[model samples]
Target: MNKQHAQHQIWRKLGLLSIVMVLLLLAACGSKDNSTTNDESNAQQQEQTTEQTTEQPAAEQPGATVYPLTLKDDSGTEITLDKAPARIVTLAPSETEIAFAIGAGDSVVGVDEYSNYPEQANAIDKVGDTTTNIEKVTALQPDLILASVTMNTQAIEQLRALKLNVYATEPKTYDAVIEKIKNIGVLLDKQQGAADVADRMSQVKADIESKVASADKPSVLVEFSPGWTVGKGEFMDELLTLAGGTNVAQGNGWYEFDSEQIVKSNPQVIVYSSWYEEPNAILEGINARPAWKVIDAVKNNRLVEVPQDPLSRVGPRLAEGLQSLAKAIHPELFQ
Candidate 1:
């Protein structure tokens, strides 16, 4: 009986040992499977990381796959440039100034009569006045042509009829003017150069605004012509606001005002453009007007004369014009 009991105990011990060995072997197999899965996951993650690294540069490349550009002009005309313009013709003085500002002056083959700011623009072949001489423009063989609202519609159509690339620019606001400069830069492949000029103008504007923040805003009037004044929703009005003044013109668009209206507005300052070749003579004429004598602007002698082109032409020099207007309106602050 004792031997049989001893045999039973040894068998039970052997069975327990066998079960422990089996459990250890199963654990080893499970660990191997988990290691294989982790290795596969790590390989996939590495592959994905490599793919992302390679694609980043191609996606972020500037101006790549963006050539042969297509865009719409202010006139809603579609224009496509196969590449950067080699030869450009500008029909407006403002457009001519913009081309020169963007460092594309060398490519400007022809310009209108009024493009006289850069000195270099005057040296270019003249294509006529705002009317645009089609014959001379055609002779220039320009790869690109820029026009503005001042250009006659018939002349613009004639240039377009010749299958010449013509972009009409008529920026109604100050922001629009900067956008036009940027677009012109992109077209000329001088994007960085254009951006630099635009940025500088922006800085100039900000600086002027900061300096004039606490200035006393006085009522002002801009007599562009004898009896004409720019109303609300125009660049002239914008300039007045920037210069810490108020435009007394109430109507929308350019309109004629009589002496009675001028007296009623009672502006504190009257700003005129150099449009009149003889600015002094024009100011004298205004000062001598019997009805204008009653107005505060004439009595106080706050008739400020600003350069016509810088204020009139919506181009790179717009900031300069704004600064000049600020100086004229708030001379004390500027000084």
Candidate 2:
């Protein structure tokens, strides 16, 4: 072949080879782009599957958010609830009553042995009294627990150590009792129910106060047991004052009184609580004290008996106790 023709043929072959190489590179780049796109799509799909498997369904969420609910109990311990308590345990009769009164009765899964009010309370599982059955309480798997000073302190501490949420109450006055009731309501999301119950109790108390505001205030002695009487700063003492009667017991809290002090105090009306099954038996025991006959209350037959639960229990029935004591101390005014 001629020299020019040979050079042209070589250049044309080189050009064709370059064109083929370019085409192959383009095909490889297109495959890499498709592979990358497929990889990205697979990663997104796997992430979506993982979320579906791990995340909770909206329907499975609780009706109310229990988390973020935090408050300091009467014992001064701070408590945080993760979810609204579906099961509750009460360690005191008064706490049980307050819980039920605030429309949280259904939530109470267990109560102390002394819980007898509201009739239904009697049917609830009893986990013992101040000496609570921690095992039984634990078995109930209560989300929330109610306690008080009345319960054994040791047991409360043990429950706390078990990581159980315990809210203690030690309301000493009628107002404090109402506040506790409302607080329980708030804890259980029953604020309206608690407010209504508290309002009704206040109205009843106000009525009694108005009726005896101008009445004569008499010196009264409240006998809890045979010789035990409540003193100042107690719910019973405040109830006496509210009912237009002065508590003759001198010291604070509860104390034992002797026949000498009773005679010296000379209470116009002697009041006995129905803690004992037979109130008359309590009166007999009181009368048995030496030199007791000389007391004005004994000689004048001014002894009266009142329901112990209503008077002593720090719960919804405290207003009833106030009225009962008012009538007992001043029958003429009530009549």
| Model 2 per-residue lDDT tens digits across residues 168-270 | 7665566666666656665676756766777778777889889889988888998755565667656667889989898889976555566688789999899
Candidate 1's C-alpha runs over 4 A off are 1-65, 279-281
lDDT for each residue of candidate 1 in 231-302, tens digit (9 for 90 to 100): 775565787798889889887655556668889999999987554244444466587679888899888989
Which 10-residue window of candidate 1 scores lowest in summed lDDT? 25-34
Q: Where does candidate 2 have its weakest 10-residue lDDT segment?
A: 25-34
Error of 1 at 165 (Å): 0.7
Candidate 2 matches the true fold with a TM-score of 0.78
Task: Kindly give the number of clashing pairs for every candidate.
Answer: 0, 1
lDDT of 1: 0.64
